[model samples]
Target: MLKFKTMLILLVTMSIYSGNAVASPTSQVVKDRSYYEERGDIVWEVPTQKKTIAFTFDDGPDRKQTPKILEVLDQYQAKATFFVVGERVERFPEIVKLVLSKGHEVGNHSFYHPSFQNISKEKAVNEIGKTQQAILKATGHTAVLFRPPGGSYDQNIINVSKQNNLQLILWSWHQDTKDWRAPGVQRIANKVLKNVRNGDIILMHDYVYNSSQTSEALKIILPELKKQGYSFVTVSQLLSQKDNPNTHIKVTQ
Candidate 1:
């Protein structure tokens, strides 16, 4: 009994040290996009026949990068979604308002950009509530869409979002441009131009650490995608048309 107890303690120590003890990604269930979307708990991408894609920019209301990205979008007559950080929205209200005024949609990204899975339920609620208040105060538009920081979420995050009436949104698995990594202009452009499909929610960031390459990548992506017969739409617009009876949904791998 003593030897068995000693081995169990050693194993527990090893597990903790290896970081295997941390309960993360909270939801244990691994399912497809349709499962979450149908339940309305989370939405990664919507099915559609309009050939419309939702381009969502996170961590924004950036003073410099945002306006440049806006210019690129305007050049193509594309409509996209900007998921604005709460504090940034507060500091750059005009930028948030400009995003709305420019025929784009703004969604709530948490105030401090903390991963919801890492925080407690109370703090998670505060993060969503405060950000919602900030966006509404600044843009005079309530955000109906909420994308968790770093795409991190748990049941608590989902519950709080439903209580607040915000749709929890995520990007298509294939359409993440990873612009925040500053993965080079060509690579970012290539990710979208190559993998893009109807109903994809493309992820790009308007506010990245230090300088942003996203605005530059957009110059390459937007025109080529437009030529490929793709039109960008806000996430809400994509969701609205997803259930249209006349629309034919495509098979996704």
Candidate 2:
């Protein structure tokens, strides 16, 4: 009993510290947004009364890592969105198929994973449009969501995305696990376990640099969040939601 109580106290303290590692989410909708804001073409979070989150992964369809992540999601019966790079999708189209076959989602994350902020309008168009074709060819999945590489965007990137009929998708403020950094498995797990809220879009990655920490962390994150009564959904599913009691309009940075 003493040991159990001590562990519980430790977890509580960890949660408090880990939860604030990122800035608190703001109810101030559309503060720093631009053309995308005017057209309502971007999203970070959509609050619904249902205890649900949109688990989004960027730069994926990696042969080994993606499959491992998929296995964990399958174990939990959780659905998520993979914002895949066009070149990677071309290289491992089967992985993309596996993602869709498992009832998950695929979105565009650019062909070369270039920063849209630094590229020209035409370059951005090539990246976004080519990726749309790549994802469609891979699994016949039309990627309506496009997340810019590194989550950095400018007016031209936004306009190009609009032309391609893609909605910009970024993650919720507090839910960045940064597992790609090979942070310890427990650290990656804690970042997510502590900060998740209803309608949050949690960011993770499958193609980390020499790291399997994401899949390992998912083993911890999925079951814990599931036990907390949170249901996971694709980004599109979260956006299509009807007004619920927990409706939150989060302003993206």
State how far residue 68 of model 1 sits from its true place (Å): 0.3
Q: What is the C-alpha lDDT of each candidate?
A: 0.81, 0.79
- Give the least accurate 10-residue stretch of model 1, judged by summed lDDT: 15-24
Local error of candidate 2 at residue 116 (angstroms): 1.9
Candidate 2 structure, TM-score to reference: 0.83
Worst 10 residues of 2 by lDDT: 21-30
| Candidate 1 TM-score, C-alpha based | 0.85
Off by over 4 Å in 1: 1-34, 243-253
State the local distance difference test value for candidate 1: 0.81
- Candidate number achieving the greatest lDDT relative to the actual structure: 1
Residue 117 C-alpha lDDT in model 2: 37
User: What TM-score, over all chains together, does every model reach?
Assistant: 0.85, 0.83
